[model samples]
Target: MTNAPSSLTSAEPVTLSEDEAAQLAEELKQQLRQGQRLAGDTQAIERMVAGLGDKRGLLRLTFAESLGTVGSAAVPALCQAMCDHDNVTVRRAAAKTLTLISDKQALPHLLKALLNDDDPVVQGSAVGAMAVIGADAVDGLLNIIVDPNNTPMQTGLASWGLAFVGARAPQALRDAAKSENALIRTAAIAALGDQIQNQGDEEARQLLLGALKDPDEEVRSEATTLMGKLNDSGWAMPLLIPNLQDSSPLVRKNAALALMKLDDPSAIPELESCMSSEQDASLIPIFRLAINQLGQER
Candidate 1:
């Protein structure tokens, strides 16, 4: 939300008596708690809409949150409020409230706010709201994450949003995995595991198989973890075994742990080999545990 000082700006500030503002704020919160709309009174709705840009941040959020709790009925008004150039705090509050309500009908407005809102906080909140909206948001969120032009921090939040989108994110995630940028690929791989996880999508599985061989160690490690989570015998041994010999110690450790999750006896030999060559005191226990688990299952 915009924090521009009221005294410094030429814009007209919201003029409400202190007692009137508190009563309205409390009324909105009370209505929200009771799961009721703002009395179905046009004047009441207008009053809450006016409160959107309250110079007081707490009051602005309270009003916005209450409007969001009102659900689809307040969506149009919230969208309208997001365009108030004179008060960016109101615009941001509207964007954040859209997320709280999770109405897909607000998708267009939220996207607009995300693309055009100058405030970083508003943009971040819009990203989060889109995630709550699910598959419809995948395409937009992917645009942010897969764009090499975006800074790492921006892509990082996009990745987080995509992860929240979960199984609904697979298609965009598949495309992201093909990005020439290793950072994008690694982030996409990790998000895919978080979202897809053993859901039995062959295309997703194949994409992960490709990730397993990625030159980037992070991608390979994440892919190994996904493979174990899949527990598919066709891949359980082949995909993870070679990782046990990977040059990166972290990759080897993850591979062993994945094998333990897969419980594939065929990996026992590889695990033993890994155990013999492993020098890290901490990783040895994991290798031994994986070996024992595989052995007992046989």
Candidate 2:
């Protein structure tokens, strides 16, 4: 066996005293105040993350808050904490920080936290973080809504995330419409129709229309709301119309509203036919509001 160089002797472990941690923290705070300069920020980030494992969660929380704003300098250390840390509060901080840093590599961890974390606040933060990272997270985000364990918070956050991912995430939203969970399915279709606004993307638009036929009444109503927003979307019309004279009053009203947006007199017939069918007479105002503009320019 080859012998190691004698000059490469094992270095003794250096321990930081109370004063040392306080000093490091102050220095890092100074660096953080500098803002947008990662070149000289490495030493400070190293010091910050090194203390993240401190018994008091405040230290980790402080580190997280600081590192999150530091951007690139904090990326490497926060990446480590996202997976390796044990503290939940610290983990929450890591998640929020990732939102500020918002890189693609953090997606897996963010998704993991969104789906699996016990804390609702943390899950909420993870979803928001996905939005900060933008369109790149569409693939994983679409899958998140379909999971059976979705809580109300998760559903809401997933909807928020999908609302931002746009048409690129349509496949997941379409598949999500088939979920057994009412909340998940409703949220999925709502996001596809209202958020993604795939009105111009024919494939996605068709999928949204297909979702309008879902068994759930709320899902159908939500889908109708989307059709209203798609007036400028240029979506292809389907052979079967959903929410037309449907059982749900909300569905019927929204469908009339959607047709009015199309500016095709053909929809006026449906709107006119819906007069008695619109369960909520209050929405009659919508029909009255929309009728004259049916064929008028948007």
Candidate 3:
């Protein structure tokens, strides 16, 4: 057996012979091709975990990737690498691998990386991995969302992350929509729209209706768009007409489109008034479309 210098503990730099390097390269290729089937063999997982300490950057990265494809079975070793590996790059690579593996069992390690890892890329990978875990990740995400010390970007990402948490999302989002911070409120409302679609939840409908009066035009516009697509007959004319006179062109445009969807005759007079007075050159086309749609229904 060829004695290789320790990449993890030795002070000496690793030097690989052409034959030895070729052997390692070939091993990585075979492991990559083998994929998750490798998880079945405890002996093979040990070899792959040991290979993460290889001095060769390419070999270390390749081995980490192959182990990731090896799925949940490889997580314990990968988590050890994230925590105990002497090399920062290798530790980050392990975190990246966990993302590909997408095992929720790795969440504790990833959350540690998100909070304690100095490397931004490593931190980002943790956030991304948690996001991929979806609904199962909500508790960790809520921590990020509510932490006052988190950067705006991180907070925003946490809000965005909540959208993927399935049924557990609405109440948290409804709370976020009431936030004093407009940014959080907007993101919460936007995500809530997709969450509530076709579910016919009256509470969510009311939330959107209330949002239509938000001080922030962007929030109001998004709410208007959601209301229109809701196809809730009661919202047809009353919910949309006032928006035609909104200060923001986007709000008025979305309202017009929503009215078109409602096909309510009460919108006809309002549409005519908006059509004649609307000064935005872009909006005229939309106004004309709504008018044509309403006229056709008559």
Candidate 4:
């Protein structure tokens, strides 16, 4: 196997002209496609990881993709570069490459970068990698979601990862939904809704309906919003009608919006009754809109 170019190991950010980067990327791709083994070549792996910093966006992406083709063999080096590399570009690219690799062994490094990285792009890429790792990443992501010390952005990223995991491994979400922490419960419920969206999981839909009465308003609100998005008029409309009188205005508003999406036309009398007694003036417009839209549907 040909050695990686010496320039790829430079500590300084690697700046390559577009054509040069393209040629290097093509060479690496050809080598890997030929079944050349990179598994035992630590120096070559690190050098290739460094090449992820190349200035050309497409070439950087190509290098990342090439590293991904190296599979689990490249993960450790990529994780190290993601966490320790001074170049934000390298860090971002390393985390992004890990996404394509989707190795569970990369989860801790990805989680660390997601929680501790200074660059938003690096953090985003790390969370995305964790998402691609799927089921194995769920517990780590749920821990972040429930950690009071995590910033909203950090928790938000973890929640996104959980949603991704839920879509692929909903059993993990079902387990998470039983957590004692309300935050975990809320995130799990939301993720379950996302799973239902993709697969129309009837069990997940039922779980979401149960959440409407959760002691926590945020859980209710999330379930309410998802019920509207489910577009399951026959199944969701009846359960959502009761939420129109929910104590939380957000839940009430969400219920209205969901009923509107259901477009049952039969909801007119219930919506009209809600509008007549609704104390929150802000809900008037929402109720009117739902009524008007449902009227047109008739």
Query: RMSDs, each prediction?
Result: 6.6, 9.7, 8.7, 5.9
Candidate of highest TM-score: 4
Clashing pairs in 4: none
Q: Could you tell which candidate, 3 or 4, scores higher by TM-score?
A: 4
How far does residue 7 in candidate 3 sit from its true spot (Å)? 16
The runs of at least 3 residues in candidate 4 whose Cα sits more than 4 Å from the true structure, single-residue gaps closed, are: 1-23, 33-40, 197-202
* Model 2 root-mean-square deviation: 9.7
Off by over 4 Å in 1: 1-18, 25-62, 69-95, 101-126, 135-156, 194-199, 231-238, 261-269, 278-298
Clashes of 1: 0
Q: After superposition, how far is residue 169 of candidate 2 from its true place, in Å?
A: 6.5
Predicted model with the maximum lDDT: 4
| TM-score, one value per model | 0.62, 0.57, 0.55, 0.87
lDDT of 2 by residue, 1-298 (tens): 1111121113221234556766766665676677534332656665666565455555556566677666666765555554445566556666777887778877776776776667777787888788777667765665666655666677668778877655545566566666777656677666665444434455556656766777778877777777766655345223224466688777776776677666666556655666646667777887766666775643
Q: Which residue runs of candidate 3 sit more than 4 Å off their true CA positions? A: 1-129, 132-162, 198-200, 261-268, 293-298
Instruction: Determine which window of 10 residues in candidate 3 has minimal summed lDDT.
Output: 1-10
lDDT for predicted candidate 2 compared with the true structure: 0.63
How would you encode candidate 4's per-residue C-alpha lDDT over 1-298 as one tens digit per residue? Answer: 1111121233543355656667877788777778765443675566577678788786787678778777888887887788877889889889989999999988778878877788888988989889888888898888888878888898898888788776777888987776777888889998886678778777876778679899888889888888877777887888899999999999999999989988899999999999999999999999999999999999
The lDDT of each candidate is 0.74, 0.63, 0.70, 0.82
Q: Count the backbone clashes (under 3 Å) in each candidate.
A: 0, 0, 0, 0
Candidate numbers sorted by TM-score from highest down: 4, 1, 2, 3
* Cα displacement (Å) at residue 25, model 4: 2.8
Model 4 alpha-carbon miss at residue 126, Å: 0.9
